[model samples]
Target: MDLLKRRLDIAHVIAREFLGIQEKGEQNLLECWLQEDERHRMEYEEIRQLLVAGEEAWKELEDGDLVAAACWQELQREEKRRSQWWVVWYRYASIVVLMLAVGIYYFAKQESPETIIHVETAAVTPGGGKAQLTLADGRKMQLDDTIRLTFKEVGGTDVSLEVGVVKYSGVDTADRKGAYNTLTVPRGGEFALVLADGTRIWLNSESSLKYPVAFTGNERRVEMTGEVYFEVARNAAAPFVVEVRDMDVRVLGTCFNVTAYGANVVTTLVEGSVRLNRGEEHITLSPDQQGTWNGDKFEMREVDAQSAVLWKEGIFYFENDPLEVILETMARWYDVGVFYADPELKNMHFSVKIKRYENINKILGIIAQTNRVRFEIKDRVINVYE
Candidate 1:
């Protein structure tokens, strides 16, 4: 009995820390407890795994063994041990199972729901290579598996559409003026393009890029709205400039990514260097650095360039992002409207790594396991609740 009490005391401290109820300095006690015996560390690991296991697995564990009475008693005296009482303790079958249930209960209490909603659905299809091309004469053509477009020349530029990529070859266009082409990728779609300037670009969903059929001016300039990853061709004589949202990205030769969604513009540099100009304010960004223009001002931060450009590589890599932000990305990729049934659920944080091509429901199922929220899909809308 005495040993059981001491084990419960250690369990209480570990549980509190795991649940984020204890302060950082308080971790010393748990560390000392673990170092005192190898079995202590093993026991803690077991408890941790059980806590993160599925709800059904936990119920099965509870049925296998758990003494509710003893666990309830130890939970009551949890705080009393911080001020006094020292004893020897060991793990038993009942306490082991009971501790797992207690961890779940604590997590559940932390996310108490003001309202309850149940939801789940089949996997919605993923986005694919699709877009629309508008010619200089204002003629729109759809690019898909069925529609094959072969244009010999678009205002002195040779254009070829093959598979999912569009290539525009350079030609003497000094004789021509005011001729441009625009490529628009709608929701649940993406496309690739090689401009006449030799720059390669990958366009994300809900984005558009407008460029001249051939470079002719003092600078090779393109206007874009949406998201694009660029590998600008080296041309010191005529610097490549991309006008996106409220900012202009100027590059002599570089690889970078620009996301101009809603009212904000985020430019992430992958290689070489680029200058971001918004009115008179200009900032230079190095490799692995990102510049965010939030309407009024620019904020610079160092980020993992690969992670920022993962969308082009067919992956969704979210590094400790908030739920609302993740859902916003999902909305564009899956072509769905996201609504929070409970607005408060939007603030929850998630560090997730999932393939961009995965089914929508599969992604939601993984997130729902966090126990912080649930999701429902109706038609093309996703509703999140607690």
Candidate 2:
């Protein structure tokens, strides 16, 4: 046999070994292949590990008929290409084997038949750019990714929406009494805004920002709830300030992220400088520094500041975050409710990085692989059990 045919035959033998249907001579052939080279042994070990890990998950599959039909189709194709039968067989075999390997690896880790409770297959789509803008006059306007238009604000400032962003220009700075506008992003939505002063802000799900139509007087200030990332415009004369509950973040020209959805307020400085003040206590943060105000006192730590703004880039980046915290974030982005049957499950920590646009199942599946917890979805609510 040719080199390619030999490799394909070896792969077929490996698949049969996993399924416990290998013929008598296949074991000796696999051993010979493993002994031929160190790389072969490593590859064989890797495939074996995947098969073992996914064994339990494979048993849970309910598509036996579909699998049998697919196998039959592959067999038919093999007869038509007798000269390349090994190649054709291995091509389809590898797909089936790898899919089984991946599914098992993700769903069967340390899982036992008695421990398997439930798994929901319902799909939940990801969030997108959507928000509502409230003018100073109490007029509400819906803004989404599809619509693009321009209009004048209450203070005669020109506001325009284009490509998922709202921009404010032609500011009447002379009118010192600037009218305010509140941008509210609901659950499963996010939006960006450019203030009249050229400052840029990105709001996360379930967030709202109240800012002036134009930066007037001696300072540029905004009050917000939930989470937001800011790129402040440089103006040494008028420093920018963000008010989040009891905390105040003051900066002249910088990029930073503030999370204030919970009792604690976290400010992560990406570049330039920001001073965080809560009543009498205050602290300044430099680039790559994070400060948290926990209602009573302030705690500062050095961290990867850029990671805090990953939401704006359509990425979910978690670093050893607790299950409760991660679920809370998912609740906002996926617009789903969460119920924990076991309180202890909330304290489980995990480090994960994934695209925000993926279906909720894929994200939850990553967690379920641990086998420490199981989840069931009912009417858009996720129930967790341990």
**What is each predicted model's overall lDDT from 0 to 1?**
0.78, 0.82
Misplaced by over 4 Å in model 2 are: 1-122, 173-178
Worst 10-residue lDDT window for candidate 1 reads 84-93
Best model number under TM-score? 1
Question: How well is each residue in 1-386 modelled by candidate 2, as lDDT tens digits?
Answer: 23445666777788777677789899999899788666567767766665565534333332444664465566567767776645444544554454434434443453544244344545667999999999878899999999899998655789999978999999564464657899999999999999988899999999999998777768899999999999999999999999999789999999999999998999999999999998899999999999999989999999998887898999999999999999999999999899999889999998778999997877887777665677777778878888
Residues 79-190 of candidate 1 have per-residue lDDT tens digits of: 4664322211212333454663454455446443422333344446788889999988899888964555667554557788977789988585455668888999999999
Q: In model 1, which runs have C-alpha deviations exceeding 4 angstroms?
A: 1-88, 91-94, 97-123, 145-149
Displacement of residue 18 (Cα, Å) in model 2 is 25
Could you report the Cα RMSD, in angstroms, for every candidate shown? 9.9, 11.1
